[model samples]
Target: MALRIRNHIPGLTAALTILSLAAVFAAVLGVIPQSSLPRAPEPLIELIPHINAIISTIAVMTILLGVRFIRHGSVRRHRAMMLTSVGLFIMFLILYLYKVILKGPAEFLGPDVIYQYIYMPTLAVHILLAIVCIPLLYYVALIALSRPIEAIYESRHKIVGRVAASLWLISFVLGNVVYVMLYVVY
Candidate 1:
C-alpha cells in the first residue's frame, strides 16, 4: 500500500490539490450556501481574522525553522517543524472558511488611495502565491512523507521544497499584512 501510494505521488498531489482548491473556491464563491452553514457566534466570527493572523505568524516561524533545520542536516526537527506548519495552515484555512462562509470576506476600510495603489496589488500577489504554493507544497510534502530522508534527496524534493518554502513564507507574510490592513490599519 505504501509502495503504491509512493509510486503515484504526482497523481495524488494533483488530485488533492485540485480538490483542496475547489473546496476553497466553493466557499469563497458562495456555492455553499451561507444559509446552510451554521452561524458561528458573533464574537468568534469577529475574532477569526485575528486568530488566523496569529496562526499565519506561527506558520511563518515554523517554515523558517524548518528550512533552517534542513540546512543544518537535522531531518527530524525539520520534519516536525514543517508538519507543524502544515497543521497551522489547516487550522487557519478552516477558520478562514468558516468566516467567509458565514459572513463573507472582510471589507477594506482603508483609504481609497492605499486600497487601490497598495493593498489591492499586495493582496493579488499574496493570493496568487498562495494558490501556487498549494500544489508545490502538496507535491513536496507528499514526497517527504512517502520516502525516507535519503531517498527524498535523490528525488525532486529539494528543488520543489525550496520553491514551496520560499513561496509559503512569502504568502504567510503577505497574509499577515493583509490582516493588518483589514483589521488594524483600517
Candidate 2:
C-alpha cells in the first residue's frame, strides 16, 4: 500500500496542484457567486481576517520549526512540523475563500500612490510567490511522504524543500502585511 502510494506521488501532486490553482483562480475571478453561498454572521465575517492572520503567523512558526528539526537531524519532528504547517495553510485557505466569497476582496483605502506603488506590488509579489509555492510545496511534501528519510536525502527533496520553505515563509509574512493593510492600517 505504501509502495502504491509512493509510486503515485507525482501524479497526485500534479493533480492537487492543478486543482488548487484552479480553485484560487476561480475565487479571485469571482466566478463563484457570493450570493449562492450561505453567508457567515457579520461578526464572524469581520473576524476572518484576524483569524487568517493568526493562522499565517502560526504557519510561519511551524515552517521555521520544521526547518530547525531537519537541521538537527530529527526527521520525524520535521515531518510533523511541516505537515502541521500544511494543515494550517489549508485552514487559512478555506477561511480566506469563504470570506472572499461572502464579502468579496477588500478594497485598499489608502492613498493612490501607496496603493499603486507599494501595496499593489507587494500584493502581486506575494500572490505570485504563493501560487508558485503551492506546486513546490506539494512536490516536496509528496516526495517526503513517499520516500524513506534516507531515500529523501538522496532525492531532490532538500533542494525543493528549501525553495518551498523560503517562498512559503515569505508568502505568509506578506499575507500578514496584506491583512494589516486591509483591516488595520487602512
Top model number, lDDT: 1
Give lDDT per model, in order: 0.93, 0.91
| Residue-level lDDT tens digits of model 2 in 1-186 | 657767887788889999999888888789888887888789999898899999999999999999999999999999999999999999999999888877778899999998999899989999999999998999898888777788888878899899999999999999999888888889
Give the clashing pairs for model 2: none
Tell me the TM-score of each prediction against the true structure: 0.97, 0.95
* lDDT (Cα, tens digit) per residue for candidate 1, span 95-163: 999889888888999899999998999999999999999999999888888887889989999999999
User: What TM-score would candidate 1 get against the native?
Assistant: 0.97
